[model samples]
Target: MTENSNMQSDLQKDKKFQRDPHFISWQWPIVVLAAGCLLYYLIHISDHSLPKEVTIHEAIENTNLFSSERSRNTLRKLTKLGPRLAGSIQNEVHAPALIEHEVQEAQSNAHSSQSILLQRQKGSGAYFLGFKLGFTNIYDNIQNVLALLEGSDGNHSILINCHYDTVAASEGASDDGITCAVMLELLRVLSMQTLRLKHNVIFLFNGAEETPLQGAHMFLKHEWAKKARIHVTVGAAGSADVNFSSADACDRFVRRFHGRLVAACRLSVTVSN
Candidate 1:
């Protein structure tokens, strides 16, 4: 090759190199800063945010009946089946079956358990009692459970409560199922313990608190109208939101029980009339 040809090649290479910029001045520094910020955030250092926590334990004690894994399994199964609305055929297919299964299992595990006793309403053209669910209405459903557990004693009692039915299209294992699992676990622990209580404890799994308070109205039907001297309802499941609200008797019970656990976590108080 001639010297001119070689020089032409060299010039072309230099021109290509010049056209391709190395560090577009601001781009490199900005990218570096972004990467650094990301790292800082992940590590939760210097105004950073960290990812969510993995479970250490149930965050409660003794009865680990409601593991997140088990609850998740229930959720997935319910999701596959779809929603569980009231007055639907699914009440027979899924809702009552789901709760009855739990009640039986809880009883087998030796908790001082109670069932709704499976009665029926003769009016309304058909039976209504078995059609009614447990976890629907908050205020009245709770009262009915209290009446069942009244056990003919004239004293106050501790109430453990949870709602079991899911919202429309919701496969909610965490929402209220978590609360049910918690109460079941607590009951299991208490049952296992040798200690006896002065006040009778009522375990309530209410139904249909989602829409109008039908279960509640039926529950308070002059029989359990008198509020339990103490009530202990939980936040909708999967929530550690142990708050007292001005909704019903269970709210008062929740406050009384939480008054003991305040040292473990800050208890928010709000009891309804």
Candidate 2:
């Protein structure tokens, strides 16, 4: 009986040892290491992720709002409004609201001392003309226009023209809106002149250069161009590529601006002559 009782006690002791959780082989070290590694990785990732470039028109294409494509489509879309008869031929013309909005915005960021209103009426028949653009302000008012007008006086009278208002309903990427931008850039660079200008520059931001040189014609009604000896009408040759420099258009512009087109914008020349 004593031996049986002792055997039962030994069995109970064995069962208790087996059921104790702490007595079993544990993996606390590995579990702790895994948690610590996960936490370390999370902290490292949080410290390493943050933005680099900032510009209003940097990703011009990526932004769907005012890209050049939008400008072109806007103009094409507006032709349905009604036909604007340029006397002989009738074509659809866009309104100036969108361009006006853009100009207003540009004025806010510009540094022009004299911002002016450029108005060119419709050109009469057989009108040949020239245009020059400098940097233009985005946001402006009537007073800004008036101030630009005030700065027109020089030794000789000349034309100061820009396509201020864009074509109505246009995503107007090109068709002279881009020209207006070129004009603004010109304005920014040209204002550093300490010497008096030779001609009285008549600043004209024609509402409809795309329509029919309307503003240019309006200004031409006066004897200013003839008096100022306006020999050249400068036009930008869009953009260029280094690889296709031998293309006809590029080659022609290079020769044109340097030789006979003295009144044109001087970009560069190929030959030493």
Candidate 3:
């Protein structure tokens, strides 16, 4: 009888606990939190997926400068002359002829006001000497393509430099072709602008860059390099990753930009051997 009484007491305790209002139910709270999070995520994704609007001027600038279609077309033309290695027949002859043809095409356009000129510099011939082989000399000529946009203030000039020559067996589409195409497009765009610029812009396409930067060394010997105050020089080191690295002038260069359209970071690297 006592055992039966104890069982009845335990049963009553269980029933009381089950009916207590203090015992919190988590089901509704969890559902609400989950729903809130899902709604927030949907809203965030929709906000980011929407298209951005641009001004008319920005649209014009986009079409005129750095047009992907135009650049790609130029790249195609460049790659047609495959493997423009330094001192090779393709680099020495075909590349120069192609550049000249493009220049002539640009000149023939009735809309542009820039002057296109081709300057040829004699390259330092290659030589190899060893015990197994005697000294051998190979002659390779350097050609520099220049497009001049003379500004009202002729004292200052900006040099845009890119090499047309490539390493052995490289089509150089990214190595330097892109840079040359960009320079050409920039010249075309600048020529179309009605407003006169303050400083002259010179486009310099150097040859034989793969062979000890001989083209640049030769350019320094020109009369234009002597008189002109070279404001900026944009060159490529055979890649699409656009990184501007100026030792002391980076801060000054950064000060010229005023928008958040692109992020720029200054990095210092240290190496140990």
lDDT of each: 0.47, 0.41, 0.64
* Each model's backbone clash number: 21, 54, 0
Ten contiguous residues minimizing lDDT sum, candidate 1: 118-127
lDDT string for model 3 (1-273, tens) is 999999999999888778556765779889999999999998788666654443335635653443545655676787778878776787778877777676666556514444444555555545553436665544456656666677767787777788888877678877788777767766666665655478777777777677656677667777666545653555454334445545574555644553442354432211110
Report the lDDT tens digits of candidate 1 across residue range 1-273. 699999999999988778444547668889999999999776566323322322315423435333444444444554444554545455335644565565455456543433222221111111134335633222211211221332334366555655555578675455455565555444544443434455556666555545444444454443333545555556543334534454663456457656586555543221111
Q: Is candidate 1 or candidate 2 better by TM-score?
A: 1
List, residue by residue over 1-273, the lDDT tens digit for candidate 2. 999999999999988767655553468788888999999998777545423232335423232123333333334443333333222122212334433343444445333553433332343334434446533222111111211222445445544444433334543334434444444433433333333344445444455345445545555554444555332233333454221233454466455455455543334321110
Q: After superposition, how far is residue 187 of candidate 1 from its true place, in Å?
A: 2.6
Candidate 3 ranges beyond 4 A from true positions: 1-66, 110-118, 123-140, 231-242, 249-251, 254-273
Off by over 4 Å in 1: 1-81, 111-154, 222-227, 233-244, 247-273
Root mean square deviation (Cα) for candidate 1: 11.2
Q: Give the TM-score of candidate 2.
A: 0.33
Clashes of 3: 0
**Two-way lDDT contest, 1 vs 3, winner:** 3
